[model samples]
Target chain A: MTTLATRRQAAPGGSTTSRPARSGASSVGRPGFAWALPATIFFALFALVPLAAVAVLSFTSWSGLGDPEFVGFENWETLIADPVMLKSLWLSLLFIVLGVVTQTPLSILLGVWAAGNQRNRAILSAIYFIPLLLSSAAISVLWRALLDPNFGIPGQLSWLFGDGNLLGTQSGAIGVLIFVGMWQFTPFHTLIYQGAAKGIPTVLYQAAAIDGAGTMRQFFAITLPQLRNTAITSIILMVVGGLTTFETVLILTNGGPGTDTTITAFYMYQEAFQSFDFGVGSAIALVLVVVATLISLVVVKVSGYDKMNSSLEGL
Target chain B: MKTRPNYAAGIGSFVWLLIVAIPLYVMISGTFQTREEFGDNGPLSFPSSFTLQNYADAITSGFGRYFLNTVVVTVGVVAIVLLLVPPLSYAIVRSRSRGASFVFRFFLLGLAIPAQAVIVPVFYLINAVGLYDNLLGIILPTAAFALPICTLILSGTMRDITGELYEAMAMDGASPARAFFRLVLPLSKGGISTIAVFSALQAWNGFLFPLILTQSESTRVVTLGLFNFQTQYGINIPGLLAAVTLSMVPVLLVYLFARRALVQGLMGAGGK
Candidate 1:
């Protein structure tokens, strides 16, 4: 119920005594005060309040019903020695490393190759997007079957290489999850690159060709540079996503065979949901928020969020 | 790379296609035959003994309920998105003078705070609200989770609609509300559809919300129901794949026609 009329009237310069007639500006096009009220209330109650609830709850302790017992730094103290939580954190880091390092480069190559040709792009697009379209359950089930070295396609391929059930080993399972992450996440990055690559005027490439630039030269000079904002954002999302991956790993291994595949996000969920440790769970989740926030800030910096939009408009 | 995609490129595309398609083909192929046949024929072979019985078995075994439930949830979520996001975007763009930036940023917070971040609290909140077992529970949260992203996209797109359009409409004796309805509404159909399709897919594809929020068959969406199905009939690969394929049909049809807008929305929201 904050009065926007006075504020709108202020508008960086104006004055105290306002015109009642100009108060309409505060309403904008909304029908009446009563009309926009529910919506304003909904956004605050659902989004702002719940978000505030998380920020506040991160510092307190309550298990669904009780008056939350005030716990000082006990939750933070627990994560200091929590091995499982630590392992999950490490595992999450490992997943992010493999995904960003390997998956991104492979996708860049795939996109470069795919964009160069028009034939079957639709089919390839469908293929990549198929995994994306799938519900997470289906992705896990499909990959689970596919990774059945004796029975799955990848398993069959590994048979040729002699290591059949890669899902059995700790490193091997992590590898498989990374592979799945890449398979699913690549299409996302590829789409970005595909769009950006297409946006590069053909004239630039033609001019490069006449100037004796080869494919590699053209890619380095034009494609990579033009994809600057996208590449930065793409990597940002990959790191954040890789860190948060849950359903796939949860379904695939359940951090399994012995704590092999656990990301920070999934690990915290297990602690909160399965172990019922709301205190430590909240702490761990807060840590994740901090980590994710740092990562996003990096993205905004590297991509220069302020300029990316304006540059796109210029293009 | 510079050529007009010749036969060699066609061959390369096939290689990549095989990498992508073989697994999907196997998943479909696996659905038609029994586990033993799946074993003997291998995943690639055309089902030597094709049968619709697996599909029939899957359909009879709660698949119909699951499909109905999925439809209800998707329709509910899409309805919520269409109703909420456009207005929210409209408000954010038009109300620039009155703490509108903060209002916009408040929603933008949901962008980074993935729905997963609030799962525990949401579960608590939903249960407390007594929508715990109802389909409406999932619909509300899914809609909530989607609104921020959808609103963000629409807000950006709405901001881009040349102000001249609104000005011209107003000069024609149209009120601000009429200009918004007549000019802004029609122009934003593409962006809004993008939000609709995007939110629909997210709701459809979501596993986490349904898995944690709902507890029984009466309200189970396809993701959770399918997961439970796999657990009970782990050995019935054919039945499982049949169930998965059934779940895929509706979304697949929409995706085929609207891949462009859908992809654009994804890249836009997902890029950050």
Candidate 2:
């Protein structure tokens, strides 16, 4: 503990003293790397270490029993040929696209609407936030009961949903998943946009009003453009979230009627836990990581999120 | 404000509200009806009879145990996050060391690593460490995964503490730890509570960790319990719906009490 204190003291002191020509007071009470070490090591042990292990495990065969035996590319080769694996990747992409397409405009409108300080808007926003309270597992279970072909809403509204095999057919199952995803997540994205909308300079809106821009014209001209960064952040979240969605599928359809909704993440869980094909699961997991990483990199590049470091530079 | 109301947005949000409310209405209303009544009346119908039997059955069928276990995990996760993230975020915001910045970037990259992608190895590692089927197994990994986002949120909060505050603390000859305790901690209450609520929700709502890491009835969390409850009581829709409602009660209570903080905390997830 003495060494820790001195090192903490000396590091900042040394840096400040070396920069004697400049003001050093701000650095005097600054923390040291020791403060970050514990969480870094803990996060690495659990997240990063296993992340690396997953990549290696993808090249080996194991079943949660014995030591993983190296099989060098066989898992990859088989995954390449597996139709379900290929289809699952497509399903994951489709989910992302559909989630973005459906959620973005709806949330943007709702968020802007909710950003109003009016009493009714506040009450409605609170009610809208209800779905966000339930866990994905609970929401899935709730939807399953609500969409039960025999006695659910679909049954009562048979004119709209004949025979109500929503979970039986491929398109119907996908529709349920997308609709549920929107129901569960739009409020969250709406919250993000609401916060961003609140941040958009009121002066801009006033100026737009002065220019005789109607609400529609002002929203198109001011609100959407100002929300660009938030849109990127929200979309990236949706992408990553869509890629890793598992519990909803598990509880709702169990990758359904015949792996029709088996996105890669769910497929990986099934392969690893259900089928006990750890190697195959790891391979699918690696694909998920690579896909997520690629998407993140693209977003960072496009949105300059990494460049947000500039804000921390002097501090 | 506009002089006139916007009917398009008004109607759109109202429509969306119906979409959001119907399932919630169904779930909540369904729990009050008997099985025969529900089957006869259909999900959309108002219940002819209201009974607390579904909730009683849910509790009697081990939801209490699941609730206790979930509380344990949520508390464990929130504790770990509170203990670790503040200091890490503090270092990231205040430390000048290269290692600190590198660690910050490391966690920034960690934001991309989803828990599902690493579950296979995590399972192996947990089993190897004899934490499988244990609550700690769920707690450790869940807290670990929460670190990236929590660090991001707290660090963002910490950075908002202007340089003048630190310089003033330095003028008082305060040590780093003293400054952290006296100034940074007090100033960062918003971030701290946000992370606490965020991690607690993650742990409370966690399904994959508990589903994969723990198998026994003794370690069952609410989400896993509800999942299993569904399969075991598939035909008993009211009981299943009641279980789902039971799982949401704690979060709903928190929501009622602290809606603003909860909403802000969730918005923090978007890095706002």
Give stretches of model 2 more than 4 Å off.
Answer: A1-28, A302-315
* Model 1 segments more than 4 A misplaced: A1-40, A60-67, A149-151, A154-158, A161-163, A302-315, B1-15, B265-268
lDDT of 1 at A182: 69
Compare the candidates by TM-score and give the number of the best one. 2
What tens-digit string does per-residue lDDT give for candidate 2 at B1-272?
A: 68998888889989998998888888999899999999998988988888999999999999999999999999999999999999999999889899998998899888889999899989999999999999999999999999988898888889899876787778678999999999999999998988899999999999999999999999999999888988898788999999999898888888889876787666656745
Q: What does the TM-score come to for chain B in model 2?
A: 0.97
Give the DockQ (C-alpha) for candidate 2: 0.62
lDDT of each: 0.72, 0.89
Clashing pairs in 1: A149-A155
